[model samples]
Target chain A: MVQLDDLDRAILKLLKQDARLTISELAERLNRPESTIHFRIKKLIEKGVIDRYTIILGEPLKPKSVVAVYIETEIPVIEDFLEKYINHITKTLSMLPNVLAVARSGRNGIIALIGGETEEQIEKFVDDTIRTLPSLRKVEVFPFTNIVKGEDVIGFLVDV
Target chain B: MVQLDDLDRAILKLLKQDARLTISELAERLNRPESTIHFRIKKLIEKGVIDRYTIILGEPLKPKSVVAVYIETEIPVIEDFLEKYINHITKTLSMLPNVLAVARSGRNGIIALIGGETEEQIEKFVDDTIRTLPSLRKVEVFPFTNIVKGEDVIGFLVDV
Candidate 1:
């Protein structure tokens, strides 16, 4: 586990909320010296604790509807073929703009977060693009009606 | 829909990768004047196309294991009670630090992203925290073995 003192955790929390904060601003907010704030941030970055700085696109760019799709591929006679097929599915889904995130679940299952302008549009995408794929056992779709926490994730992961 | 020109998208794409890029750097990369880059960025922010700036934590802070949990609550005789129960469940789940994201899947269902040190720990958390909740009809856990796209989301959403 990473050893993070209260000061380090405080800085991290502030940065997570707003990465654009200047050293001086952080110093003032955290009641620390500017030099100390600068040094700590530099050390954090050097230690790989601060991975990257990025922007989250707002509503103008975000999809109106989002869904989580779980896909389970049928186990074929050749085990090797299943591995290759799963890789292919993940890679193919990753390239699509609407497919916000993709991950392998267990051995034969895959999970994806998809976004679209409307529920019907996302459903159509699943039917035409996902369901049509060969050698699948089951595909379950979970629609997100209201996001209670981490709602900004859609904005964070949306494509330009 | 908000209208965005190619230059706006180009700038957004670059910023998404690295928000710390100076206006001059963006201008050099996009082959535009620094003043123009500055003006465009200002306009984008004013229009709310560019949301807030944020940081993604590195591996040291990210949970080693993540799982997507789908929870469905049993509908009660009173529809009013169902709404309150769903709200209570989502709010409770959202309060937990390990529950990275929570969203209402439907009237009676919820989907949450959970993280922990190991898969066994996460499963134990689910068993102790989630399954014990009253009026739950089903609780499904999908362990993420490999994340092919938007993997940084764990880093982005993980709490300090």
Candidate 2:
């Protein structure tokens, strides 16, 4: 089990906001010695607490509208094909750039986040591509009108 | 409109994978001169194409179970209170550490991603915190059995 002290949590919080912060900058902000900050960061990475450094894209690259499409496939008589069918759907959805994320819910369901230029476009894509897929029983689209929390997710998940 | 040529897109893609990559490292990988890579990165930052550098926490800090909860509120007769009611709900959910993301869906709906130590904990949270809220028409929970794409989202959105 990994136990994080107050200092570790604080360092993580700061890095989550801006990983580019130098050891000196982190030390200044946290009121700690630069060497201490450096050593802690190294340990965190080694322990697999800090996975990797990355970037969040800006508005220019993000889509104007976004929606989460939940699709539940009707169970087939064969039963053995359920996993294959789900895999196919997930793989096909994963290939599309507009589909930011794809996940399986239970044995017969798939949930995906998709983005487009407008609400109409997203709806159309869902209707044309997702709904038309075979064996799907339910397709629900939840439009993201305004994100109050974790608002930058679209930017983080958007493809360059 | 901002236009991204092949070189700009390539640089952005590489940086998205590893923002900590040095200019020389990026140049080496992209087969471009170090100076050219530096100049392009500078311009990308200036143009707001590269929003900000950040970090993704590893699995140790991320929740073991995740779910997307979709809640739809019943439209009130007064009509004017819907916005306030929705805003109040979103703000409240946003304050909780377990609620990873909150987004408004149309006028009467809100979608939230939540995380917990176990599936039972997440269910209990929804039953206690979400379903008990007034004027809710529907509450749907989609458990993430397997994430095929954007799997690190929970780690990225998890609070320190």
Name the candidate that leads on DockQ: 2
> Which tens-of-lDDT digit does each residue in A56-76 have in candidate 1?
999999999999999999999
Q: What 10-residue stretch in candidate 2 chain B is worst by lDDT?
A: B11-20
lDDT for predicted candidate 1 compared with the true structure? 0.95
Q: How well does each candidate superpose onto the true structure, as a TM-score?
A: 0.98, 0.98
**Candidate 1 backbone collisions, by pair:** none
Clashing pairs in 2: none
True contacts kept of each: 0.92, 0.90
Candidate 2 docking band: high
Candidate 2, residue B94: the lDDT equals: 97
Docking class of 1: high
Off by over 4 Å in 2: none
TM-scores, chain B, all models: 0.97, 0.97
Question: What's the interface RMS deviation of candidate 1?
Answer: 0.9
